[model samples]
Target: MNDQDITLSRRRLLGSVGAAGATGLALGGATGALAHSAAQEEAPTALRSVGATAVPFHGRHQAGITTPLQAHAHLAAFDLAPGAGRKEAAALLRRWSRTAGELMEGRPAEDDTAVGRDAGPCSLTVTFGFGRGFFGRTGLRDRMPEALAPLPRFTADALDPDRSDGDLWIQIGADDGLVAFQALRALQQQAGDAARLRWQMTGFNRTPGATAQPMSQRNLMGQVDGTNNPKPSEPDFDERIFVPGDGSPAWMAHGSYAVVRRIRMLLDPWERLPRGQQEKVIGRRKGDGAPLTGGTETTPVDLEKRGKDGTVVIPANAHVRVSAPETNGGAAMLRRSFSYHDGFREDGAPDAGLLFVAWQADPLRGFVPVQRKLDSGDALSAFIRHEASALFAVPGGPGAGEYVGERLLDG
Candidate 1:
């Protein structure tokens, strides 16, 4: 379409954007009047500034690990087709990587679908990783990182075997739904005979510019989540989240380990609690996510502060207290998570919660320790169920002429 036509199309799309019960930029004209049709034709799209944004496929590390959360996401796993081995796996990675590289640039892949043909890149990212089963299936068991070992069972776990583990994992994210879906569909088609889909989950976060200003996102439970995530500026941020350049296994050098969990939040019971009680469960003000111990959201939590009644301000079993780094020997994980809702269950409770993807140099020092402590006494556990889990070794990003996992696959 020509520039004028494109501008007019977007104006119409924006005019009808808002839905009764939707998140993100649902409505453009809630109170203010919208531009007349004639004027709209001369105006630009609201998303025009951010639409052309594109994340480079090649980098020191994969895009999604530390990349800011996108508006839409698709998390999927795949098992190698029967008889597929190292050579097949390597070939599949090449094909998948090529398609991923192209799609992230807002271009159609070799096996193209027109689903997102008219959309911009939208800052699309496609990340690839390998689960524990991947090494064995490809005759590379000796090279599997210890960090990819099975996660120890937790008290809150009610895992589904079918959806838990896979030989391969892919995380696709984008500011626009269609862009994310385009990557997911293209990669799945590229897998062809080498890998078969195991389990897939679609998720979303508040769309970019959905609010007056960017801030920590609220989960389905209506709580500000991930308030204390490790910032990239911290001196130890890279060491905590990604392996050292000279780290073990050689291939995992710049890579990070990802612990993927599908935690289902039981909203019925949680919402029933008085607002006061709900805040106690998380130990943070629901409005701004500040600790009950006080200050803004970024204020350091004072775990030792007590009330006049001789009780701790932040409850002993509060989720934040039990999961804090200070209490867990400095263990921390970069929680790049997305909220998921799969309608309702047979019992009628909304089957919605978090697609919790935590990244760390090693699970032994990251997710495992903190999760163990949470299992022991986290009050939030009472209202959530751990439904699925998997650990993937995400290798460093590919360079010119290189594909993901190339070092290990060819080692």
Candidate 2:
């Protein structure tokens, strides 16, 4: 049949099957239609995957402040097999990258890509960071140096041998809840028989009141969340995010450190509190995320003095008190957090909280110290609990098709 006639027939067939199944029906006839159908069939399943990487864009707070989306973050620990060297790991990673690209572009696999299993909708963005022991080894010695790598200030003392001392992290995002599990499955499959590569996954989501705005907007809790956050798209971001000096390796510079915390919110009890009491605890209004001692949402908080009656306006132990710039001598960390509303608990109640994510040049000096300070019996502790946490050293973008940290790890 002529091209037009074939097209007409295919359209008729597709119409008969309805849009949902039309592609499959059309594939049964014309060669071109068959090819298209195969392509559609090969497309990755609609699954959730994790996305873990350093913050790249400027003005991140704007997106966090404006969006209503919630984020859930989790951390998984893994190790590599003894004989599976870097080359094997690289091969696996390259395959993963290929699959991820296809999935992102809506392509599916014709056969199982890894573990003899077919590709699916869920994919992950896996990023690597070097540890002291990784650089100490001969296989990677020439590639990495202690001075050039991220200090192992955040890792736990009980190290996993099979897993590289180096860090591998993944961030998965989706409109569906299954994405996280799917991404984990993919990672497990890719690891294969190798027991040396150990990993941990920490999940976080945006808060209920979180908007995709910058500083001064209120999140679901009615208190302004990031009023004190550093402004992106400015020269300061360059200085803060990028490591200074020609002495540093080219790959190492321009990257920032990532600190992740899986905080559990006590929503039920938090909601039970009277609105005024809640406002006092958060030091802001719930609807707007504004400060209790308010001006506009973006207005800087006045933590210097007490209220009219001499009682502390913003309580000394409030979250804002610990995280605020004024109280901490202008200490800062880039926060790109999200709220999460996972499925209900066994009791049929929601298990929800914030996926607290932050980035900085120095985790020890920036995030850990700040977190330690905030942990000091703050008013925010009343409604939030830190269930899981981890720190990752994220490299900057790659140049000319090279992935970030490719050279340092000999990938």
lDDT of each: 0.85, 0.49
The most accurate candidate by TM-score is: 1
lDDT: worst 10-residue window of model 1: 24-33
Model 2 lDDT tens row, 159-237: 2334223335554443223444444456556656643335444444432224464334334454546656677655676
Off by over 4 Å in 2: 1-77, 101-166, 174-188, 194-224, 244-250, 341-351
Residue range with the least summed lDDT across 10 consecutive positions in model 2: 48-57
Alpha carbon deviation, residue 90, candidate 2 (Å): 3.3
TM-scores for every predicted model: 0.90, 0.64
